[model samples]
Target: MALFPPKNPVPTPTPVPMPAVTKPSTLPPEDINRAKQLGTCIRARFAQTLVGQDNLRESLITTLVAGGHILIESVPGLAKTTAAQTLATSVSGSFKRVQCTPDLMPSDLVGTQVFDFATQKFSTQIGPIHANFVLLDEINRSNAKTQSAMLEAMAEGATTIGGQCIALPKPFMVIATQNPIEEEGTFNLPEAQMDRFMMKAVMTYPTAQEEQRMLTMLTHLGSDTFDSRTLTGDVVSISDVEFLRAAARRVHVSDAIMKYAVDITATSRGAGTKPVQGLSTLVRLGASPRASIALTRIGQANALMQGRDYVIPEDVKAFTHEVLRHRILLTFEALADGVTSDQVVDSIVQAVPVP
Candidate 1:
């Protein structure tokens, strides 16, 4: 008998007709121009502070425009924290950074009721979670109990304290960073919490040329700390970010593109009527409906950034890895074989027919 029994083959069902692609709404030329300008300014500021990792920069901007949260994973010294902070500083919004640790408590994140002896009353003191842009640095270092405290805020844009629900500041977004190289004193984020993030950006070491440029830039700056305030001319207000987000929402998405995004996520599950070959053996779980929704929204954001008013297949393909990398759960065999989620996503993307 085989170590893992692989017996049944799923017979393909008769194909159902896909819905007709409806015309999508288009953004005004002025709005499109504004989006392009904002994107360019943000990227330019990022370039001044960071050497490379263009993809990571784009992912951060895309997530911001899509009104979604992002999770960044990288080894130490990759500038993950710097990238997030730079993006936060680019916008004129309240920013807070939480250095997560095993001792962090739920009350330390959300607010807590404090007794006001002088006033003879209790007051609700807000925590760092109330900021417009919140960065949870080294999130995995915190215990699961402390991590659970973020679920409500991240999912509903509100946090509960002492039976009172308080809304987070407008244009709220969470940028979480985790170190993949460290496993000791770390807790694995639950799947439910992980799904809350719209995208997971994996950062890698920069190329030789990029590293050399970084050295020269830092040496010229005369210090290791890079001040984002130097790009004051490029800073955008909260209203500007809201405008770009509205533009992204208006960017048209055809039914064909919608289906294409859904198909890519579905094929990963091995639960679809027509499953990809060997997918079931490798994947223990697949992405949720949220993944499909994220793909569409991020695609719209990407389209707007590229000076287009409508999403295209290329828009959907551009960020497929970032969108689905964290959602898929691999089996033991796949891990033993050293297969990665990116490889799995590539296979699924290839298997699904492009619209």
Candidate 2:
């Protein structure tokens, strides 16, 4: 890693504001019969209700099927929160939402021990993280201490409280949102924690047509309360999603694609000759091996979503931006030079040869 890499130092511009639930999880069927159908239904429902954010819908669905945490960076009113809740409803899973505040505590998320008055025994009280789907809204607004509590569940499916680690629910997934363009009263996520996320998705503005559709949907739903709970119609049985996840683990990737994925990670490293022509100077650090692994798993999920049993390079490239964008740290020099991680990823994908 370089002691210094040219990167963006621009003061994060204060940007637009964003506008933004829990239920018992029915055990999904044990069979993997409807996983593919579930994935398609989730996407379709989002398209209908979300009105826009096509890119977010695609990347988020990929991460969900892959079973990984995602960090979404966008201004408010972009439906990041709504999307998380809606996805949870699509699967009929238990959902929990935590509003990240500066005063939030670790125990508030991971849980603590409470003394039972009758027995004088300290029983464990689980926190919001025990649910199958969790939405950590405005994650950066919380202090590091509060943020630390999420690391375990997000990374290991367990959280430590009262000196004990409690396992979270099966198929746990967290969709954490941060305001990347704001600096007020927000704590930067520790690098170690950042690596735990499978992807950092940037939500872009909706198209004019999409925005118009959103308005129309809002008009149609007037007084109807288009809440996330409404997403629970028969999409796929819970069992089907479970089976699909198991199937995704078996999705085939050729060795050539594997090597190509590794090469991309290695080339992103700032230590050696830069793999992408102009990036060496801009990046202080390259994508981690975890990034490589995530890329592969996400590729499999992509293939699975597309009803393919095997992965292709295009599938790998499909998620490169979201999977590696935050993993690659840009140098102050790169920022000064107006270089973006998206550009670096593009350069690497274009320059890397397919096998």
Candidate 3:
């Protein structure tokens, strides 16, 4: 006892408690109505600004309501990035845009551990991926490593760093863009990257009348004064998205429609003798099982947007092109015959007998 008492005893410190993990809250019925109203408002606002790009506007709203990601391929100066940010801001969702370059790093996306000089400890510094809505602008311009880093966040909905796993904010969606006109020095997305998207939307130029309207608007407001976002009055809150997403969950999908969805995806496999004569010859790689799931989810969202209690075959058909366009890889023969993936998808739809 005397020998032990001579030495000072060390005291143990209390452990710091970790925060409790909780699931994201659900949206109430009232919030769902508000979300639908907000979707209409944003769609109208974007349509006026984007000019004759109704298809693109529909794609944006559909993808957002569906809680899915979209990849847009278009020429430059079409407001692709601007539209993405405006959509995010219009919905009160935090927007982050990453202008991809060849040298961007993974830390530039999922964040990194930074050493605090004063605290003498490493602190976590989150990157752009933390936002509710993220746009990887010119995604193909970035190298493969950067692309993979982005895909990780999209696929897993979380990122691991420094022996810790962090979940992204709920209702997270990624809208990446690619410039099709530019072939030089652009890193094409691999098959894996394409599979992650729910749709591939192509933005075409405005029609003659729409272009005239745009020019008139430009002349009247002037480039310096015209602000497209000004039209998006009464922005939708993120909570509204939560409610609408909940509503989409309640939308009924019948067994007949379920079989129809499966058949569409199955035809994409290019296996077995089907009504479409050259179906297997056209595709080098067909849609996967994920496409089937996406088709159904997107169908439900479409029905909900239309104020319907159940999904119809038309809902599946409406989104099939967008769902399968990016997923199909046309064979050399298909390309040689000028048979676009869109055409092949149409052929498959025609071949498959509707239940």
Using TM-score, give the best candidate's number. 1
Can you give the TM-score per candidate against the true fold?
0.92, 0.87, 0.87
lDDT of every predicted structure (CA atoms): 0.91, 0.80, 0.81
- After TM-score superposition, the amount by which residue 149's alpha carbon in candidate 3 deviates from its true location, in angstroms, is 0.8
lDDT of 3 by residue, 235-273 (tens): 778888887777777777888888888888888886523
lDDT (tens digit, per residue) of candidate 2 on 1-355: 8899889788988987775323223323332335566776787778657876777888888888888989999888788887776777777678899999998888888889999999999999999889988999999998888877788678778888788878888888898998874557877888888998998989888889888888888887773344764553465555656766777877778888888888888878843234666666888888889998999999988887777777899899888989888888999999998889899888887777776
State residue 183's C-alpha deviation in candidate 3, in Å. Answer: 2.4
Off by over 4 Å in 3: 1-35, 224-229, 272-275
Which sections of candidate 2 miss by over 4 Å?
1-33, 223-226, 270-274
Worst 10 residues of 1 by lDDT: 225-234
| Backbone clashes under 3 angstroms, per model | 0, 18, 0
- The better-scoring model by lDDT among 1 and 3 is 1
Candidate 3, residue 18: how far the Cα is off, in Å: 39
Which candidate has the highest lDDT of all? 1
